[model samples]
Target: TSNAEKELPDAFLRRCVFHFIEFPEKDLMARIVRVHHPDLDQKLLDQTLQAFYSLRDIDGLRKRPSTSELIDWIAVLRRAGIASVELEAGMPFLGALLKREQDLLVFAEA
Candidate 1:
């Protein structure tokens, strides 16, 4: 609407198309996780997904980790030979999830 009309240039708006999407539920998140880590065990995938949700729920994060970040983090952990997801063990790998130094520092103190 009105806000978009005023904020976006008419030329740009004419060429742009938009769609609204519902946020994916837990089961969809599980499928996304599996897609990125096909060989990951089911139990581990579930745990990883829970960790992702928990991380997103943290208060006052500068840039909360999203599903795409979760995939990258899981890949990094897998490469590091992490067989299970523990918050402490995964702490060092937050760079893959968080993009901002401020967010990393805030997360460390959490």
Candidate 2:
């Protein structure tokens, strides 16, 4: 359950069983997103997922945004009435996904 396994004591780690989960692929992610935002526009959802995966692929991100952040970012975009065209042009509500200042700068550079 811990993201920082290296920070835990060796003795503590020995007592625990680890199971790592990979990030969901696009189709799987779409289904997960629909569970949260059933009425989201398909085009917007597609664009959002594309941008989300791209962001995750960026190297040297301090804290890569996770599934929960993706959901929150999409919610903000929908509520703010952002268009899919705008999302395609550039990411909106980026702060909702990227929390670190350095990470945002890294993403901007990318």
Candidate 3:
């Protein structure tokens, strides 16, 4: 109580509220992908998600691609008739996943 009083004024604290949100699970993410691309082959969906998650794990990305970005990327892949969802195959269509030039360059150099 003393620490809280010392660090924060009562007036300021009165306006604050806490909420918890659990990270979306893999199954949820998969469902998001499916919703965006219902006609996408199951194997391709799985492979693309694996690659997308792998990209998120890379260090120093200015911004990691979101599930929405993944959907767009998959759409791009389908439009280009890319069957395999490997890193190399998806490289050309990276614009869908990464919106910033720095992020794209960082990924390219990585």
Clashing pairs in 1: none
How displaced is residue 92 in candidate 2, in Å?
A: 1.0
What shift in Å separates residue 59 of candidate 1 from its native position after superposition? 1.8
Stretches of candidate 3 above 4 Å error? 1-23, 85-90
Question: Relative to the unseen true structure, what is the C-alpha lDDT of residue 61 in candidate 3, on a scale of 0 to 100?
Answer: 87
- Expressed as tens digits, the lDDT of each residue in 1-39 for candidate 1 is 324224878887788786666657889988877887888
**Arranged by TM-score, best first:** 2, 1, 3
For each candidate, the alpha-carbon lDDT, in order, equals: 0.75, 0.91, 0.77
Q: Taking the tens digit of each residue's C-alpha lDDT, what string does model 2 give over 56-98? A: 9999898888999999999999889998888877887899999
Candidates ranked by lDDT = 2, 3, 1
For residue 60, model 1's alpha carbon misses the true position, in angstroms, by: 1.5
Show pairs that collide, candidate 2.
Answer: none
Off by over 4 Å in 1: 1-10, 85-90
Q: Whose lDDT is greatest here?
A: 2
Candidate that would win on TM-score? 2
Model 3 per-residue lDDT tens digits across residues 4-72: 225777787698775565645677888888887888888887878788887888898877888788888
